[model samples]
Target: MTATKRCIRAEDLYQIRYTSDPQLSPNGKSVAFVETMIDEQRQYRNHLVLQSLDSKDLTSLTVGAVRDTFPRWSPDGATISFVSNRSGTPQIWLIDAKGGEARQLTRCKTGVSNPIWSPDGKHIVFSSMLSPEDSFSDVEGESKKEVQKVIVVNRMKYKSDDHGYIYDKSKQIAIVNVESGEMRAISEGPYNHTVGAWSPDGEWLAITANRAENPDKQHSIDVYLVPFSGGEWKKVTKSKGTFFFPTWSPDGKKLALIGSESDTHLHAAQKRVWVYNLENDEQTCITAEWDVQVGDSTIGDVRSPGHPNPGAVWREDGKGMYFIASERGNSGIYHTTLDGQITQIVGGSRNVYGFSLHEKAQKLIMVVSDTASPGDLVEVDLDTKEEQRLTDVNHDLFAELELPAVEEIEFEAEDGWKLHGWLMKPVGYQQGQKYPMVLQIHGGPHSMYGNTYFHEFQVLAAKGYAVLYTNPRGSFGYGERFVQACCGDYGGNDYLDLMSAVKYACNHFDFVDETRLGVTGGSYGGLMTNWIVGQSNQFKAAVTDRSICNWLSFYGVSDIGYYFTAEEIMANPFNNPEKMWHHSPLRLAANIETPLLIMHGEQDHRCPIEQAEQLYIALRYHDKAPVSFIRFPGASHELSRSGDPQQRVLRLEYTADWFESYLLTAEKASV
Candidate 1:
């Protein structure tokens, strides 16, 4: 007899392989992409993989334990430009499409990223952070000496999450010649600059920057263009809001961009598609009435580090362009005309994270993922919407495991607002059997819990527990008003929305045991988890990661605390201390009666580790329920998503262990 498939375990993370950044060749006959996996050392290994569209033959173009990503095909498709760190730091590298040894192109001390070829393919443009006095050729080898220097902070945005300090270096755009191996800066200043699209004629390159005198205090990031010969930059937008990912039209008369006009509450602002007419200098929002956020906003943790959003893929005829959009729970490909008409090119219950267009073939190669599927490259016919699976990086591993299927749930909140969510029954579940349910909340509060593969949820389901996740009022994909509704009302209506969903799930689902309930989330979700346990002891166990306990402290400590707290909560410590304290989860610490497990990254500047420390001490000081804290050394806010592979696995194991300890019976816990 054949053996039954085993349930997915936390260690299955090592067996899973991720593929991203699919780049279709100029002729639309082949594809070059990046494949990533964890090696024996628990470090990430990425390489370029080339495959023919017709034969489906796969070949690795570059091989190393180091990262090789952001593959961009040259104009003639003869060579591919990619970013690699084999020599110590990331730099642009070129390799022939067919095969051969790759050649390093840039020698900048600072690493480069977002590498794109000029229209003529003679030069590759990339962005890098460099000191004001440093040039592309200032490649001085560093001395292996350890020293401690006092950190001087003059800017409000000095410390960030992953990149600790940002006062010394600024992002600049530069170009490197493929043949001469020479590099020159196109735009330079003590300001951040990002590479956009190159004009079809290769005369100008569109860039995203904020050259305002006080950019640190402003939210206006506009588009600009610099000539190939390198001179003054001509501002394209009026600097009214945040704009980026500018793509030039085929005729070079227009530029399609994805951004928002809101300056203050950008996190709640809807990402819309806009068009700029260079001839008349008119800017219009094309996706204004679409009621969908442009670009892929679906949140998932399965993919590798390098997933670039391929902004707007202009059609060959230049009448319209293809872009990714999110609505409800799925993010799909959409097409819009210059006149504002829109159509769905590809719609599904999945997340189209990235895609590349092949104008000649009338097809697009997309990196797509859904619940139960990590992600894979898919070829879709634009007209018919017919999809063909291209690569299966984790097919073998998935075939041996039994993954839970998500059941979409639509229920009304307490205030009559309809909310969307998903429920996953325990693995090997039987009808009429009671099971402990864990409510999983997503961070970003602005981000959505969509139909994407989340390993953490799968691990909980495998532990014989039902997993419930929902996109509450503050989540994307539900229109602008719904997403913005939870901003000012932190633990108010958003709290009610989550509790209503849990109540709905328990009332509707027969297998859910209301008495044995648990809650967990990270960041904003963590804040909400803290809020939920304090408001009522409906939950028996809770796990909060990278959470915020005190709003007053977070307003001063977090990287974006200065602006985020003011904008999201509609109050600051100086102006409205009482409101901030009233909304803070720390104020309700004495009411927490559930067993809690707090997890945080030591290096998390976004939601500093001090937030966790404060909460742990407060709970113990109040002598409430049991509380435990776990600090991941050297990890950042991205610990759960892109931290060390081993730590990510451990996080899952710890979460499951915590939930099991509190919610499960001794008989089931032992099993």
Candidate 2:
């Protein structure tokens, strides 16, 4: 007889670990990736691991207190360079690939991150903040110290109350000589520059900079080229749209960058990739006919999956570049030529992250995911298109568990827009026996819901709840036009599309009980949950995390609020405050009848905690609904993914408990 599976709590069963950011060595003989492991103490820690191409022998390169990431190999392949905070603050560390004590390279009071090795391997380029200094007086020849202070007077529209504001330090690129240990500033200015890439000859460095005349504008980000030896910076493109993820061609004659030229919140207006010629300074749109924008384009409280943050690299021959595209489903890697002819290199239910080419072997190494697994390193044969799994980090844990099965579904929105969705039936589910259903909405209204494994979804299914998540309009993986359809029409057609997904599941799935329905999400998804509770009584319980409730207040509070509001949500916060209010879920709190469990981090700089407090207070004041508020101490906006370990488990338990009290209990009462 098959052994009875032990019941896995939402917290205990969700400790599955995986690998990410796989970096192939320069010689193509070995691969290094960030291996995330959950220890016996249940603490999540990251360490660098190496695997040989020939023997497939895996070895751990780092072990200790701090986390190590962004492993890049030197040109000689004898040493590996990475970032770590072992010395109190994040700094560059170098260690032999065979494993030994890592030597600290940079010792700055501030932190250093995003380390990229120059082509020659003699220098490492990274970005960090500059130290603050006193202002100098020319006439008096006396130094005047400017005291920087931060004050939080009230907690209203801003989400995070405990967030302490400090003096702003612009992130500048710096180069450290590997041999001399000499650190020199390569690019210095008032504007922050990040996401650096090196040219083949190491003569130039390409980076995505917000050095525009109006750096405050969220849409003003563009790519720029700077001399590797440190001098003047040159703008590559002048479009007012957001451009990032700059990848230089092998020949260094052209740059393959992802960008969008429109300000519309919809995917269509925000999705496009451009190739710029360095010689002529001419630009060409490669994805113009894809009818979809690339990257998530929503300003505030909304996200899209299509925004390719880690841009793909060009083939060694520079004939084509590999990139991930998402329109209506999960993201997949595709090869696109300069002429815009695209070919799907890896197509599956899962999302394919950026790939590293093994030029000599004609193989591609990538990170991929599906509903059953979080993410794993896989190698695909470029010519044969065959995929082979390289890592089994989570295999042992998952093999003993009974995970949910994700099935794709489609439904028509209120406006007849076709939407895609995925449904996860309860574990040990039986036909005829009704179960509670949870509707999971993805943020980035531009982000697509695909075959990727979601911990929360699996935990809900294990607890006898059927989970349903959909790719509404504005979701990626479908192509440009479909994604942009929801732009400027937040909580309108997208709301209908999500509701239709719920309706379709209830009607088609035999075990789904319509009366026992719950909804939960984080970030943009969190905003939708707030909007859903306010607009409908169909859901019995709802949980919203790191959400934006009011756009007017968010405009000044969020780091990206000013630009996101102006470009994605509103034309101008000053003139469009009413429109922002109209789209805000907080404005309709009076109509909410569903019990809400509001969750937010104390240190969330993205969507502050005040947004949660506002909804919690409003719900408590209402006699019609029950409410609960939970704050994660010392947690940031990314509490769900990168927060404290214990808190992450608690958050999941809280969500399950909220639904258990409302949805499951209500179903039992009716029975």
Candidate 3:
């Protein structure tokens, strides 16, 4: 008799380790990265970890209760600098590569982030939120005393999902003395400045900012070169499209940027790669005809929502570039020439979350993940295209956990739209037995369900349910045409495409029990769940999470409502009330026949908790369908991925119980 392996539990996610920001040392023998985990107290604890290729051993540089992240090796490779909240406020901290006590380098009043060491390694450039103290040397206590508590807001983009209110302070670029720990503001103005790559000569720092007189109204943000010695900044690109993540060439004569022409199209715009020449001030699109979007656009619920793409890196000779892009569900590294000739470097059905390149060594360090693995660091050979596992952070836990096997498949929609998706089989199965199917929809509608590890899906499959997730019309990674196909067309072909995926699965896979089917999703996916249930009663149960029910009201409550409302639906609530109501799921709430469960976060500013409340009220008031609503207290829009540990576990447990209760007759509720 064979002993049964332990199945993955919902609570097992807390023990999983997440890795990011891999930095290759100058000598390319050592790599410094960030390792984060959730503690019992429900707080994120970050540690600076180092690994050596020669010794094949791991070392923790800074480990404690506080958060430390964004480890970057200096040019000399003697010391590593990172951002930490050890002193109650986030500031730049530095420690020797040989290992010792870390010393705080910056004492910014508003806090500092995104630290980049100068080429000479004598100074570090970072972005920090500023205050009007008349001096940059004000200490913490004195700085707070100078500012008033009351905040007056007057900007259209006053609040964001990550930041509740960003009216009082704006981010400014500054430089810090490495040895003396002294800092001075470099670029301080009414607008914010985002740090990009530093020029090779250390004279100019590339920055992306909308310096237009009225930045909030315009979506145009161009890359500019700011002087390190402090002076007026010069714009390098003149484009109507929005631009970001500018990377300077090794020779500092050119810059590679990521942008698109769909500022009004919201996230539906296809991100294109462009090269900007500083000498002639000429900007040319490199990937305009490539059809594929640039940068890592794959979406996953396993990691943090706001993952920053460091942009394209110039080759050692400054003739080509290496970047990561989401293509056909896989986020992999690719190479492109100055004339737009593209080639795949490390392409496959695996997710490359973050990468760091050592130009001198011709080696790349990346954080890789897949359906079976959350994340691990790996070393990649640029010339050979060979990958060697460097760190097996989750190997122990993964070995003991029984996860379902995932298989990718392709099918055509009713309108002949070719799409790709993955189906995860049940953990343990009999030859002739059929299992209930759970169809999952992704949140961003813009974000694709790619080749990434998702703990929630694993727990559902471990409970004897087959899972089906697809990238509908609006998801990224397919191409510009496919991604922009769903703009101003929500609840239309996209809805039918989802149903087609289920139909394809039921017909193609004999193990899928179509009679016992359920559908669920969060954010835009949640909106679809509400729409799916109302539009069709084919599924026995449905769960909508952090979803938008009434678009008419969502326009006023959501953080991105003002512009996103018009960008997505093509009109504001006041201008097209009838169209907005017609698109809202609440309008068709009475037609919902399937059992519905509403889930949301109380502090979710993106979709807002009011969305769930409205849907619950509409469903409950009429008593049309058996409905339940679960609200995670103090949880934000990212509850399922990076929310409170206990809360996240509870959410998965609740989701599994909900599906089991409806899918199987003899299923017992898990507490």
On TM-score, the candidate that comes out on top is 1
Pick out the ten consecutive residues of candidate 1 with the lowest summed lDDT: 139-148
lDDT of 2 by residue, 235-303 (tens): 887846767788888899999888776655423455567899988989899878876445422221111
lDDT of 3 by residue, 436-505 (tens): 9999999887877888898888888888889999999989889878887877788999999999999999
Give lDDT: candidate 2, residue 189: 56
Which prediction has the highest lDDT against the true structure?
1
Give the Å error, residue 575, model 1: 1.0
- Candidate 2 lands at a TM-score of 0.91
**TM-score, predicted candidate 3 vs. hidden true structure:** 0.96
lDDT of 3 at 614: 90
lDDT of each candidate versus the true structure: 0.88, 0.75, 0.84
lDDT of 3: 0.84
Over the full model, what C-alpha lDDT does candidate 1 score relative to the true structure?
A: 0.88
Judged by TM-score relative to the true structure, which candidate is superior, 1 or 3? Answer: 1
Worst 10 residues of 3 by lDDT: 138-147
Q: Candidate 1 versus the native: TM-score?
A: 0.98
How many residue pairs clash (N, CA or C atoms closer than 3 angstroms) in each of the candidate models, in the order given? Answer: 0, 35, 0
- Rate residue 351 of model 2 by lDDT: 64
> Each prediction's Cα RMSD?
1.7, 4.7, 2.3
